[model samples]
Target: MTKFILTAFNPANGQRARLHYDNATSELTSESGESLVQAVEVVARANAPAVSKQTPLAKSSPRVLKISLGLSCNYACEYCSQRFVPRADETNPGDVQAFVDGLDSWVTSPPEKVEFWGGEPLVYIKTMRPLAEAIRSKFPNAELSVITNGSLLNDEINDWLDRMGFSVGISHDGPGQPVRGPDPLQDPEQRAAIMALYARLAPQRRISFNAMVNRENASRAAIQRFFIELTGDPAVPIGEGSFVDAYDEGGIAHSLRPGELHAYRNLAFHEIRTGQAANVQAVSSKTASFVNSIRSRRPASSLGQKCGMDKTESIAVDLRGNVLTCQNVSAASTAPNGQPHHIGHVSDLAAVKLNTATHWSKRENCPSCPMLQICQGSCMFLEGPLWDRSCDNAFSDAVPIFAAGIEFLTGLVPFHIEGELRDDRKDIFGFSEQVKPSRDRPPRVFPIPVVAA
Candidate 1:
């Protein structure tokens, strides 16, 4: 029988829920199934438990590590949650080495995958190269990826990436006039550069676009059309969708106008339902099923519910070797007393403790929200000055607006109706049929050379 393991890491409770599966029988049964809450409970129990016990569970290796190289970024997007920028004097080799060493030791057995992230990873390519090389040498089996802006990509970087079998996730805001800041490149030039990279590297490497939806771009139907056109190719991976909420200078949540908010929600929902968006295609069948199951348990008011930073599979580390509990918060807040915390230099393999209690909590307030299952208590950093507090008002207000928009968009695409309405007979989101056609659709032609695999 094919065996599968499912583990749920609850940072809030500092506990895990693990399930072992028998694929042949399509059943989840554990060695301690009778005593476990669910089949996956076995896997969770293998990690930390929600409740304390005399004999602690064996620690399981993390399945993925999201290493945040630093807070430095090239763009100053208005809605940026972390508010990161390249700090000229902040990049330290000692700190990078410490974190690398810790990761090497922590993952001696290694996880299923590892991803490198940054304000812009290319900025520190020199520092990152050696580490990437080391990881490749140590864990040949690990799936490696880098989340970058793609502005600094060149032949040399591309060659390195090809050799490492690295997957690339490029962050761009479709063809809407630059809302985040000045265009990284001027009009035609910018588009050309982006397309060039896509053509040269996409076939050989797994590449996808992450587009943040906001008011300026979402308001323009042309922008959405441009997105569809840009990523429509079968060979070229397309857009990955994410919501960008406007924030005030103090980092407090700012209210979005009902219409603007509605537009953003509509676009995201439309993309998911129609399979017009990018990364949606790449989401695993199992993970998609899990998300749909959670959605079915909630009412219409919580469509975008469990979608946030915490549910993500990666963790963030900074230039100073500080391991951030969550990347959504500013660097200062991620550290103790709002000061940066360092794990160790890149060369030392030491375990580090995160004071998660301060930034994460699951309270009564959360259970009452209709989107609780989907949202899982919202962004940890957005809860309050201390992470433990609940953002009750924010949760209640945002759910309905988002849900309405999602529903409206899904309605526009007839194919998704059965899936959205929870008809068991239909495949989840009608994914099997819709996604393949959408992906096979012809892409708009561009001048760049399509990279050969």
Candidate 2:
């Protein structure tokens, strides 16, 4: 309900501008009451999709279907979200026939997107192949996608994926591969398979090498350079180039320390402004969206979480028909607050509930946070220390991009956000409000950014 005062400075000179941002109304205006938006649309706050412990989302005919193949993987990445989730019995190829048979009953109509998820999806290729094939036969035009570590990719699998028009995302940490375990790029067979798949799918713009940034791998510029060099493609699109959320001990260990936030944001902003990360999907997509939000004066009431899983029409389920809060979790697991991840069964769509999550608006911080438009709150189900650490990482990670979006639209880089937020989050890019943008320059040159949930 409170409007935030943003302290911004034009890099051309030491001139400053004060802009007021209203989170609830999503209006941005200057000192003279000139709205950043040429026109503003006032939507009722009652329209906001608010979910809490008692008010959980209910699933029905879904437009976005996420099918969890299983919580099994070949490589145990240091910060994998599924690493600790209690696994149900492993789904096998035997379950696909029955899953496919029941899909029509619950699906009702053709889904817009059908994404296959796994601890590493290809780990369940046998089950995935049949499941995806059946879904494809039923809804050929639906967008089929999967993300993997690329260790299991082969010529046969690549060909099948290409024929099916699947959008494949290889999850590699680029230079941060050491911390993620074995590097597929280092293995001759895996490298060849990955590159071959890339060559086949790049023509259709269906492949992207996804990377995650953490305290250990904070530089998107470095990550971008690494992928471009490895792939020999100047414009290779990078996916998920955002900071990691702390799901467990490994995630917390890899999260940015309190002391590192300023430096990280500075480097990130420097890279973004210089176009070093222009090809990063997260950077391009998020910056553009943030800018549009300003132009439209997008109200927080219309916003959803970073992940669309909170919507009633966006549902995730396992092979056995167990509905989940999201793809990263398993039905056999329990959320940190003791809520069951297995909220319901797909057979009874009307009975399915998403109680494991709390919507962004339900959280005390999100409604007043400066980065609400871009962050929407880190992970809907995460709680306690994990949520705190994840929120910390997300704040520092978003500040630079938030600044970039403001700089693009108003020619003023935001240095501080004055609002009812944590004191440390006020000074963006770790520069005091008194400092000019030109004087508070990044130590190194070159860049580009993404907004992840």
TM-score for each model: 0.60, 0.94
lDDT of 2 by residue, 1-62 (tens): 57888877667664667788877666778967887666545334435577766888889898
**lDDT by candidate, in order shown:** 0.44, 0.85
- On lDDT, the candidate that comes out on top is 2
Residues 1-453, candidate 1, lDDT per residue (tens digit)? 133343222223323334443322223333365322122221211211211112111222356666666657776666565573223245544565655566654455666677776667787787788878877877788899887776777667877887788888777666743666556545565556666666666777477665554445543234445555775654344444333433334223323343343333444444443444324332222224333433332222222223222222334555554455544443455332343333223233234333332211233444333333333444433324322212422332233223332223221111111211113212212232433223244422221111111
lDDT of 1 at 442: 44
RMSD of each: 13.9, 4.1
